[model samples]
Target: MSLSVSAVPPLLPAASYEYRTVRPVHHGHMGEPRTDVLAAEEPLEISLVYGPEEARRRRTLAVTMRTPGDDAALAAGFLLTEGIIQHKAELRAVVPCPDVTKAEERGNVIRAELVPGIVFDEARLERHFYTSSSCGVCGKTSIEAVQAASCPVLPAPAPLLPAALVHELPQRLRAAQAVFDQTGGLHAAALFRPAGELLLTCEDVGRHNAVDKLVGHALLRDWLPLHALVLLVSGRASFELVQKAAVAGLPVLAAVGAPSSLAVQAAEQFGLTLLGFVRDNRFNIYTHPERITG
Candidate 1:
């Protein structure tokens, strides 16, 4: 039987109503001033639960203030992106707080169980807390520090990305941004063809989670080695995002915003090309410019 999940509320923004004044419509012509409803952003908290026993022993791992929907997927994707849990086998399950009888009283917390062989340590868990899209991984102050925990490098393949396809990406991305249109409070990550064909896109209050969901979807499909395609993010590039892209074997990572110094370093070290400021008809290539051509 399924456990109740009242705590899992709406994860995305929904329209709300408010009063507003309209243009000159003479009091009698259009009646009184108009009022309308508009959607606003929703904030959600992502927590972790773990214990050796069944009762009196659940601890919160990390709380990600995020959009509420996709809670299960968010937790799973976070673990994957953070390199917390490797393969699906390493996870027994990703579920809502089991204390259903009093979920409302306890707040919205989720539990992710690791397989017997996979144990989470305090130091390993500490890394997750330090994460933020702006500036995380402070201790990885040097290049060598990044490589020590890096995933295997993926080789580059000359992909045949058609210019015509690239032109269609932004529109497709816009169509899928249901939440962004409402709240305008989130970032998006999309995977598309090297030739510019769109594949999938995900949006979230947090830029990192959006990318994680995009990459996690690919991971679930065993579609790593994304040499034939490219990744585009709606915001600035960060080292954490770069790390997730590398782990997924995505050869090129492009963002519509600026690139952080650490992101450039991580991309170069992992054999991935990083691009930023991907707007208008131009983009800045941080590394491996060979991938783009006239």
Candidate 2:
């Protein structure tokens, strides 16, 4: 039997939503004001600390505008997907950076301290200039640069499942998305077992950040190389999302929306199963259709 997880994970920030008063319009007429919930969007600075114990080095890695929760996971996911650190052992600890000059900025910063003596790649840091909530690859120089990154070859003859099993994933993912239900504005990523058991889900204003948060959680739980499971996204599948899934070694990726051209190419290149428009009992298999049975 699967165990229930009630406690929160470590390093997760508080509520991901906020309440605001707004006037609603009914039949082009202004209605009474009411409190509305909105997805909280804020800047999270992911920084890294490395080097020897006596004299460690630190630097801001990337800044992302995301819903304020599951931050440590976001940092971890970004590092692994960006090919910075390969595994969870590379991370010593993920904590809030308290050295900020502004008190308001204190908890908004996350510092990932790398295990001492690990090789640090300074060049990889140069490729990413900035990441926005809407686009994760905003700072990447080119799609070629992203595709060129090393990825493990997925095993041949991927797992197969009934079409009905895959069709239910979007609904399952939607049910797990507590934040999106409240704000109706956040994007989400979810993981499931090959047998269709839901594992974890996360939400963020940025589609990429949601994927990263799920990755980070898996990393901390030693669930890397998610080779036997499927990944689902609440929005369109982008090339960067495919790259992130490949880096994490996921076998199948399903989207409730469409897939970009580059995303299809990346899925084919990485040997991953890509599914799009997975809703209403129908879906499109962009790559490796052998993985989805009748």
The lDDT leader among the candidates is 2
Query: What are the clashing pairs of model 2?
Result: none
Candidates in order, TM-scores: namely 0.75, 0.90
State the TM-score for model 1: 0.75
- Count steric clashes of candidate 1: 11
lDDT (tens digit, per residue) of candidate 1 on 207-272:
887877676565545565556668888889988788878767688888888988888977887788
lDDT of 1 at 285: 79
Candidate 2 lDDT over 106-167, as tens digits, reads: 77999999999889567777765224236645333334565555566577766786788998
Question: Evaluated with TM-score, which candidate comes out highest?
Answer: 2
Whole-model Cα lDDT per candidate?
Answer: 0.64, 0.83
Q: After superposition, how far is residue 272 of candidate 1 from its true place, in Å?
A: 1.1
